[model samples]
Target: MSINLEQIDELRKRANVSYEDAKNALEQNEGNLIKSLIYLEKQNKIKPDEKPCNDNTFFKNVKSLIKKGNETKLIIKKNDNVVLNICVTLAVIIAISAAPIVIVGLILAIITNHKIRIVKKNNEDSQVNKIFDKVSVVVNKVTTKINEELKTE
Candidate 1:
């Protein structure tokens, strides 16, 4: 099939390829404009309908979520009355610093009929709550184990 000069020029302009490359693509694809474009794309001489990856909204949202998680409050209550309220980061620090105390406190809370609730201060979404729920489950398992061991002894 004979490829015209106009077809080569148009392909060069659309695909951002050199004159020789565009002409070669047209020749290889049997003078079909669509197939020539596909050939150029396959050869990495042109990008085919690509969306820009410059959007920073995803990163911004992740940063905001991290900030929100840091600001989230953990409220410890005894008999429906608030005993302690601290941010999640601080709670994590305290838990790390006083692991034994934290475990003993949880056990005591269980015995004294206390409730622990994690609350997100600014965000209405449940992302932070979901994380806290997982943490609470782990804590509950540890406390239950400790309770069992105490009973056995």
Candidate 2:
């Protein structure tokens, strides 16, 4: 079925575009909502895609994004078994009562353990991972450097 008039109207409101523009985009794109949105966005007509910004749909999308973000945060905040164990072992090896080592170890443990969790979560979340993948490389680099420095010292 073609995109309905109500939906087009809603999109117009959400996107903050003129009635004629929204109608033309949807009609020109032939029921392809994403294409219509892309057209509008490319033409500098809207805010370049949002959560649709209406009722349950927008809120649900927001919640899903929040959930995805939270899951990612959890993954970045946990440590894998090997990393955690190594952290604990290092703390012990570093000093008798090395508070700094222990704390750092704990932090690393929390960070690396999150990897698998985030990976698993990405499989379930569509756009969530796309957003994160963009920044993953930089984050990985910083974390790797931190790990290397900690190991050396």
Candidate 3:
């Protein structure tokens, strides 16, 4: 059986294989383009389009964030002793629901020589750690500025 130059060239270009391999494939498949392509694929001479792996990074980050939140603690102290200890999530809820109450408590704590501390129980390096560290730095700066202002007043 004879194979045409065009068929061989087409198969060679489509399969990204050498001319000889393409000719052999076309001849073996009786000059059928689709069958020759399939034959090349089956022989591992051509690679099929690959699908991407499922990325679950977002879900992993969310899970880690939740875990970090659970492990975070807000401790209110007076005279080097813990007066109140609560998880970060609960503190946030209280702070949000009763903003003025929280502010008053903080001001009173400052006036009475009390200390407020945020403690992270988890020590693992993660995306959540980066976010929490940045937030902590900002909060610390703001708290220090407020304390300075209050002291001067």
Q: Point to the candidate with the largest TM-score.
A: 3
Each prediction's total of clashing residue pairs, residues at least 3 apart in sequence or on different chains, is: 0, 8, 0
What is the Å distance of residue 9 in model 1 from its true position? 24
Q: How high is the lDDT of residue 136 in model 2? A: 53
Which regions of candidate 1 fall more than 4 Å away from where they truly are?
1-66, 122-153
RMSD of each: 8.7, 16.9, 10.2
Candidate 3's TM-score reads: 0.41
Error of 2 at 103 (Å): 40
Which window of ten consecutive residues has the lowest lDDT sum in model 3?
123-132
Tens digit of per-residue lDDT, candidate 3, span 1-153: 689999888887788888899999988999899999999999999854453543468777877876777798777777789999987788878999999999898776655556667778863444544554565566667788899999999
TM-score of each: 0.39, 0.28, 0.41
- Stretches > 4 Å off in candidate 3: 1-60, 122-153
Ranking under lDDT, best-scoring first?
A: 1, 3, 2
The residue pairs found clashing in candidate 2 are 75-114, 77-110, 78-110, 78-113, 78-114, 79-112, 79-113, 80-113
lDDT of 2 at 22: 84
**What digit string (tens of lDDT, one per residue) describes model 2 on residues 37-136?**
8899888889544434565677888777656544542233333332222222233345467778756753454344333223434445445456555455
Model with the higher TM-score, candidate 2 or 3: 3
